[model samples]
Target chain A: MTQTNQPEINVQEKRPLDTGTAESTSSEPRFSPQVDIWENDRGLTVVADMPGVNADGLSIDLNDNVLTIHGRIEAQNPGKKVLTQEFEVGDYYRQFKLSEDIDKEAIAATIKDGVLAVSLPKMAPAQPRKITVVQA
Target chain B: MAFLPFFGRNFSGSFWELEKMRSHMDHVYNALADGFNQIRRNYTGVFPLVNISEDEDNLFLTAELPGLTADRLEISIKGETLTLKGAKTQDNAGDETLNYHRRERQAGSFSRSLTLPVKVKSEDVGAVFKNGILTVTLPKATEARAHQITVQAQ
Candidate 1:
């Protein structure tokens, strides 16, 4: 198992301080999609469960050390009357703060079955180097 | 719209509060995720979250089910209620020896029954699942369809 000096992935339903142009159709509350973060020798991987989110409706941004994931959920039918609603449906918002160890430019992401997976590669200089034993 | 997580600690004590909320939400989500197996801990309310809407002739019910396939799900309509039952199995790539840093996504069986507002023809009902969202369209019965009344002005 590869060792990671990073802390646990903290996910929350909060918007970044610098809000971008992400418009929602409804006034319903936006929930934070549950996510799982794991690290290996190569880099870190983040998997998020975002049901009802389409590829066109998902957006990811990395500004400075802050990384944000946004997803917009469409209504079942446009201009239809809702009879019953168990859980509110709205946009999905979450963010993470990246350290200097991560290579922001090398980040890649893909969404399948409404699950978003992001790969954040670590910088070469930040990776651990094996030290060889020498006779002193 | 609230406190930022895993970012610069802009406000003191707010991170902890948000963490609490996140855990609480996770608990609820996990409970729903585990409700299908009947062996879930912290299982409380409903399982699959749903949204029911009605148009002129059909009623649409949409369910949020991530990573679920047709074989794992079962849908039935009994009288005025529509029941949704299914299970989600974790795909571990046959490697249980691998260590997991954080395991939040869950797998379990869940059954949820919802009562329809109006009568629907079971034979004419249509369902489609796309992108992890299951949408069931139930056409209204002949008597349940809307009747328009026209007024004649003098």
Candidate 2:
């Protein structure tokens, strides 16, 4: 296995979605969930953090080589008076453009514990071949 | 390179330049915001961002902790203070051959403590972790709850 330096973990602040440019019709606030992506020889993997979003509330869409991930989180404990509102509960929306080497048809995804992982397999590279020289 | 994770390296040359400039601007803006937050909250950028709310019966504290199991988390409340501690480890840490393209999600131990507004029944506090969200319900103490006063007609 190739050796790689371990990344230092630090607390990352949440970024609210820019509703002005979003295509979604809902007026509810949305956030951009943090993600980790890596590529190996075989494929690329994307892991996203989307708390409070179950499998039923998540949607992954691909169009014209652009992949979009959206997760909806229903409001929790409604009608309760907020005391200390440090963070807001909202939906998650993010999109990415994939490279041409990826095989879009073979893409797979799974969601567990509000974490979504997506696998994008790379198209097999053309193998070089040697041709025998023949006198015609 | 630190901001490259925000935008992947799949854009064209000209577009990539624009993205890089945008990321630089964002970095500056974020730095300024962080400075302000340090002066105001003194506890900004804490892990597992939380929200506290209350109803008539119980006080609810919710925290977003994705990819963490119940066993990895520890929640405790003493007096009017609640403390949450947890560790998040990457499942793919053993795979060093993989080349990371974008890595914004972090893995490490985090702990946060907050003081409750009102008194709660320490023995009756209940917590549930579902869909990566941890919700702790602390029932209000009897003396802290609002009591109804009956009207007497003379």
Candidate 3:
């Protein structure tokens, strides 16, 4: 039996997805949500904090080695006069560039209580394999 | 309020309209940051940000707490102050043999208290937790409630 060593797991550039520069006068603003990424032998896992975002308002897409996560928050402003407001209502946007070692076809994402979790599985060969040693 | 006229103008009047829109977007974006700065200025130590607004009868306070369950939270009101306390737990802690490449999420206990602008009826306070945000509604005290005034002409 032989053992295969997976290439160094690397998580590349985390930034905002460049949609376009053609700006429009939209009242709604978009802010980059905070995210935490963890990795193990299996693959990479990304968790994002996106409060006020529901399942129906979130969209995750992976294209051209770039993973994009977008969340739209419904405006919670009541018709009553707003005496004090400390936070602004806006959408959440973030992007991550995936490496070739990641199996894009097997990527899965789930959201619970406004927290988004995306798991990127490693390729078959990248999985850790156990090899038996022969008696010398 | 002054920007209303600019928004009401025709879109094709000139190229400056595009510039106006761009600047307006910048203003809105900066306003968000400014709001955060204001909160930080008022509250010194608070894990999650909170917003407080009031109507004639009820005062509303909202806070964003992602991944926190209602069962782990506690809310109380005393006099004119509202208090919130909770402990946030980190997920995937049971596995002791796994290697982690990066860990940035913080987990711990926190307590926050804020003084309400007006007296409230603590007995009628109600709260709702949904989508990681907590909204607490405090009914105004009878003496503190807003009252309409009428003018009579002799």
Candidate 4:
């Protein structure tokens, strides 16, 4: 699996996603959510930090070899005057490319406390196998 | 030892001097790097970015803290200052044998204190944690609240 080129500065602060090439129709701004990806013998795991996003506001899709994750944040405070604003509220969007060795049908995702975890299991044939030798 | 002219008895002494100089430079470089890293961390700005809003009666403070539960957060108010403290634990990805492709999230303890514009009733403060967002409501003190005065026809 591989991800597109993302700048290193994105790790520090939330940045608005580039909408020049994307087909985003919503007027609400979208921010790229921070994620951590790791691979083990079983499969690959992706953990994302998406604060203010509930279970009903998250969506994950896989088309062809591209996997996309989108999260929406509902308006928390409405009609209240903002006194000191340090961060902006927006939705989250990110995408990743998957390899053929992964079992696309077996992918699963779970969310808790606004954090999302996606598990992509590897195909059986892609797993490493050990063979025992017998003396003839 | 006789192959080169500089490989005489002074070789060991000069070699020690060179080694000491190299070690000194190494220490200086490490210190400089540490200072840069410190500045970078701070330049990235504060953790759990907060937004404070207010109405006529109450002031609301909200912060985004993902992967944290209510028990991990502590909020306290003293005079006009409100303090928030919390620690975020790292997730367990089974074992250490896994190969990391990308890592961006951070886990550590954070403490932030902000002074409210107006004094609030400490005893009546309320806080709620939902969807990794923390919202604290502080009601304005009686004396600090705006009081509308009635005008009688003179």
Higher-TM-score candidate of 1 and 2 = 2
Q: Model 3: per-residue lDDT, tens digit, B1-154? A: 4565665556445446677999999999999999997776555445555778887888888887778888878998899988887776667877765566556556666677788898999999999988878989999999998678898998
Measured against the true chain A, the candidates' chain A TM-scores are 0.68, 0.79, 0.72, 0.78
Candidate 4 on A1-136: residue-level lDDT in tens?
1112321222256778876786688877789988999998899999998988988999999999899999989876578899988788899999999988889999999988888999999988745779989999
Whole-model lDDT values for every prediction:
0.76, 0.85, 0.77, 0.84
Q: Residue A38 in candidate 3 has what lDDT? A: 76
Over B1-154, each residue of candidate 2 has an lDDT whose tens digit, in order, gives 5665566556455677888999999999999999987766545646667888899999999888888898888888899998888788876887888999888887777777788899999999999999888999999999999999999999
For all candidates in order, state the fraction of native interface contacts they contain.
0.49, 0.70, 0.45, 0.66
Task: List candidate 4 segments past 4 Å from native.
Answer: A1-11, A20-27, A126-136, B1-45
Give stretches of model 1 more than 4 Å off: A1-28, A124-136, B1-44, B91-101, B149-154
Name the candidate, 2 or 4, with the larger TM-score value: 2
Best by DockQ: 4
Candidate 2 CAPRI grade:
acceptable
What is every candidate's alpha-carbon RMSD to the true fold? Answer: 13.5, 11.3, 15.6, 9.8
Alpha-carbon shift of residue B46 in model 2 (angstroms): 3.1
Q: Which stretches of candidate 3 lie over 4 Å from their true place?
A: A1-27, A126-136, B1-45, B94-102, B152-154
User: Which one wins on lDDT?
Assistant: 2
DockQ score for candidate 3:
0.20
Residue pairs that clash (backbone atoms under 3 angstroms), model 2: none
* Model 3: share of true interface contacts reproduced: 0.45
| TM-scores of the candidates in the order shown | 0.66, 0.78, 0.71, 0.76
